[model samples]
Target chain A: MGRFVSIWFRYLRTDWFSLRQPELKKLPFVLRSPSRGRMIITAANSVAAQQGLHCEMAVADAKALVPELQVQDDIPDLTDKLLRRLAEWCIRFTPLVAIDPPDGLLFDATGCSHLWGGDDKYIEDITRKLQARGYDVRIAMADTVGIAWGVARFGNGSLIIESGITIDALVNLPPEALRLEADVTERLHKLGLHTIRQFIRMPRTSLRRRFGQHFLQRLDKALGSEIEILSPVHPVELYQERLPCFDPVATSTGIEMALKELLTKLCFRLQRGQKGLRKAIFKGYRIDGKVEKVEVGTNRPSHHVEHLLKLFQINLGTIEPSLGIELFVLEAPIIEEYLPQQEQMWNESGGLEDIRLSELLDRLAVRIGAHVIHRYLPDEHYWPERSVKLATSLQEKPSTQWPIKPRPVQLLPKPEPIEVTAPIPDYPPMLFRYKDKVHMISKADGPERIEQEWWLQQGQHRDYYRVEDEEGRRYWIFRLGHYHDKIYQWFLHGFFA
Target chain B: MLPEAGVIMILNRKADILTELQSDILRLQGFRTVNNGLLDADLGVIKQAFPNASFPLSCIHEFITSQQEHRAATNGFLSGLLSSLLGVDGVLLWIGTSRYLFPPSLPAFNLSPERIIFIDVSKQRDVHWVMEEALKCKALTAVVAEVKEISFIESRRFQLAAEQNKVTGFLLCHQTKKISATACASRWKVSPLPSETIDDLPGVGSPKWHVELMKVRNGKPQSWDIQWVDGKFVPIYKTVSLFTEQNQKAG
Candidate 1:
């Protein structure tokens, strides 16, 4: 019979961080979160718990018992990152490992246990491996995931159950083992249904009326009747290489050496598959499980080791090896099919300069964001805003010819309205006032009629004019609506140059 | 002030071959010009702005381009002038903060508004930085920057970058606040000239510009009444004074 295993790390917040600050483990300490004007204990160490201090103890109360107590604020995000990294390390035990966030791991131990002799030895191997790494772990294997989770957290630490005895094993465990909230467990205890067996034997309609369908669902899942599916955390990169350092690397040169070795191995593998990476991330995992990572993207797919190394060389300063790094991982998130090209005797189509420009673009992109450097492709539209679309890729060519007539080099993101004074109704304005400043028109070009886009509902039509002021400065102004209208308005739209 | 040896003085109707040859020779040595040189054969058909005008594309030309503080006419004249440099296959970089030039109006200048990329840099220092980097990029056809103030050192750096990369640069300085000396091969001041009606038409005439060469680096400085007509700029004769002269001659 197949079995499911749950390994719950009870005090994830205090344990994961205390591994870095080793001195905290020896003292009575509690990770606290500030509320209003005081602190509440979020997680406590063994010494503090032994001193009768528990989670949610006020700072003053905890301090009165143990005057030498240490307090640190809880960081949920940092703890979550540490848990995921630990799960990545757990991949050696089982192929399927799902993270139960805030602190636990569920593994599908279905049939691979014969290699370690039996389920007992297999569970022992995992416990010892993680305990040696200084994590307090509880392991329980059962026929179902829910029962495994309940037994690991509430029942015996290493309770390995036979398939048929799953129901008997969960009868004595608390209602909280079914993962019900504290409120629900309190109400369940009031009805004398304090264990999973008590709740399972209740009249279905009565249980549904009081605790709702959720309580019944949890009860069913805990038994072998209903199955639960665990979603395993999958690593982003399909192609990755990891190097385990015998001694932690502290110097930049040591990191460079490790990176060089990883890249050479990864590139050779990619070459065999005729694929080149477009995006690559280099991660340095510290001994404390905190990771510092730097990623670089390329203009085109590249398999050359030197090219990829050069891209990484400019950004190596961002990675800080605090307390030294023990594991180095290089991952390629995206790969494109790129075969090795033969060297041409003559330079073809000025390809060398193009490559050099692309390299410069990549370096600049890493310094600034990739979106800031933009290329343009012309869109076939008469409206100014829809006339151009941004080219996302470097190789995009303009699909249409450039407009033959004069267009402003710069475009006002939006049109600004102006005041106009013309001697006649339909002629270009003799003068216009914009921003409270009057510009006497010395040369008026046209009442260039531009009707509203009927297909798209915009405002009134504009009669555009290319008018030059006395300073030889030209403006593209327009009258919204017809001249005969009583509410005709003028807008200064663009600069000519 | 620059030597008059390079300036083509076409103030009269008659063709001056000596002046034309000198201007052509100066242009051949890669002198920056405000107007493309005119020929003697185009005397009646086209009034000449310069004796023989041709823009030198390989060299950096800085013009101290300014206008009256009250009116916004320099943009129109520049848009007309910049049209000559826009035919290149590469894109043009326009770095500025003021959103005055409408993209739809660019079609009037025979330029694809899409071919010009707009970058809005709020800081004056960053504007210069982007301009310098863009100039050093040889792949660009031209670089145009609109700055409220430009220092001599900054303009010198622009010239050096343009020269090293062999790309043309158009630096537009807003003159509403203050006018400082700019270091460039040429300096031009443009202001609006009244339009001339086409025959007896009731509507406005083609746009006319009173272009003045305030400072010339390697060419002579002059001013003319230049007008935009038929996709090109044609020099207009001072008709009011010329008509009076003809009447006095008849008496």
Candidate 2:
């Protein structure tokens, strides 16, 4: 079985210093500064020099021995954030990516290295590319994860421990290489344990009783006696596409252009997979300590780039760039495939009427607001008012005609009251007042009685009359209820020519 | 005021041409103008004198050969006079007639057909309602009604509706009534005049009109002969030389 390996580089800060000065790559110098005013010496490779300056000495005393010593405040958070961004950039190398603590990346290159011309070449290309981009990097390849980590940190001169040879390769390194704390190492040193070889050669039961089982287990793993697994920083299921700027982009327009490129790439991948995207999220990371993110949704599944751009256009106003964005990524949730609509020759002459109507409704809904425009349909009721239904314009059209009686051309929103004075049985009121006008009838017409729907209500009966005034003006007036009742009321219904 | 004066000047110029045309036509001897603006008197007299005069009924009448021939011979002769008569405020009554026939090829005079109300009542009792309604309305320019028969009481009612409505009643006397019997304001006979060939066109000129004055309420009954030209009535004259020339042409 192949051993799981994890490698981490120590003194990445010092490496960064040497990377800034290419001519000093092989020079042996230690970085020193006293701990006064929160300043501490960040690098000391040898114990003699560490004692000379003293780990917690004042800057004035440390500068006495080495007057040209270099000092830097520890900024672990900034370095960690930078390492994350660098790890994200390495995503193109392999999808199985993980972050190791303190400036380290763990890539499961088991099956991915051959695509980039083998594991050795892939590692060399990665380190050389990062170096060109002003990053200091140290890499190691080993069969076991703990051994690879120990080799990358302390073992020198291109150590490539072959599969199943982790124990022999890590035996010569110091006990600190087994990832033990300083206190543990000191206690082990007091017990005359100087190197990992001597510690591993000791009896296992005695080691366990003295240092606990956790320490022995960690040491055994470092020497390839056990196996290990790393949980990747990003899962394989997450779909992401990325764009790296050749130069640091500091403008909104530049970031937008890079975003479009990234979105195009992501959409193409989705289409090739026979999938559609329903939502897309864009993240713009700046060189400075700032991150901007935007998310947009679509009503329908689409792989069309223009439509995705339009959705992003609506959301672009909210993303704020504090410094300037240098990288862009677009991720999407993929949906299943749907069949395309087949076109008919007849329909080609003039497209489907439903589509045209839907387009018109969409425009109207946008202009007048969604709820203002409505369509009326027949309801399953006998009463006139209750027989009509109103729905918003976006809803589909109802397909049936009204079942009620044929209504007049004009209908008053509400009925108005009138006053009538006449004997009821023979003819309608000979004299009536409507809208503040009193008229006497000269010629009278028939009583076209339309009864109220009894199934809906059993209450009232109305008698309608067409009456001509002395001036030849005609009116359709109605009396609610029978004439025998004292509460019988008269109302003017409509006009006739 | 200045624009009104200018408009009056233009009107005076138009009236001069009309007066000149009238005098030239009156230089001859046979024509006359009766009851100057009383359209009912003119219609009654013309109907009494010539009952066969072409009158359009509906849009379809314009297709009839007899009406076309009659109108061709008359040259839209009565249209201008009738249009002028109908342009007033009154109820024009065409009583006792079921339908008022229309002539084929009757030149449209742009008259408002709504002004003429048709009341078809075979029963004599309904004539009271028609007359009452007509009398109640003063806005109607004419009321052409048909009835079975008319009496003195009916004639008085017709007069009342016409006066109250400020309208002219064209009472088409029934066939049973004697020619000199009905009490109307005036009566006459009208017919199409002889067709005259145009000097320059292949077709003949518009028809000429020959009207005979059979009776008048207050004036003497005299016949008027006229010709229609460009939608206007021009009196026909009978000079010694012109008459002899027309006679030779006829012979």
| TM-score top scorer | 1
TM-score of each: 0.52, 0.32
lDDT for each residue of candidate 2 in B1-251, tens digit (9 for 90 to 100) = 99999999999999888766754654464332333344433443333222122121110001011222232222233344446665542223322223322211122432322223234444456544554444434443444443444666666666655554454554433333343344555443444554344564322233355554444432234566665565455557532222233433432
Name the regions of candidate 2 deviating beyond 4 angstroms.
A3-7, A14-38, A43-58, A69-76, A116-119, A156-158, A235-497, B1-251
Which 10 consecutive positions of candidate 1 chain A have the poorest summed lDDT?
Answer: A343-352
Which CAPRI quality tier does the interface of model 2 achieve?
A: incorrect
lDDT of candidate 1 over A351-429, digit per residue (tens): 2224434554565566554655655666776656666677766556678865554454445678788887886677788
Per-residue lDDT of A14-97 in model 2, one digit per residue for the tens?
A: 566666665434443345543546455655433325446544555555666766555544454655776677667877777666
Q: Tens digit of lDDT per residue, candidate 1, span B162-218? A: 877876788777653555565555555666655667685543456566666544444
Q: Report lDDT (Cα) of residue B17, candidate 1.
A: 67
Which candidate comes out best when scored by DockQ? 1
Backbone clashes under 3 angstroms, per model: 36, 38
Candidate 2 has a DockQ of 0.01
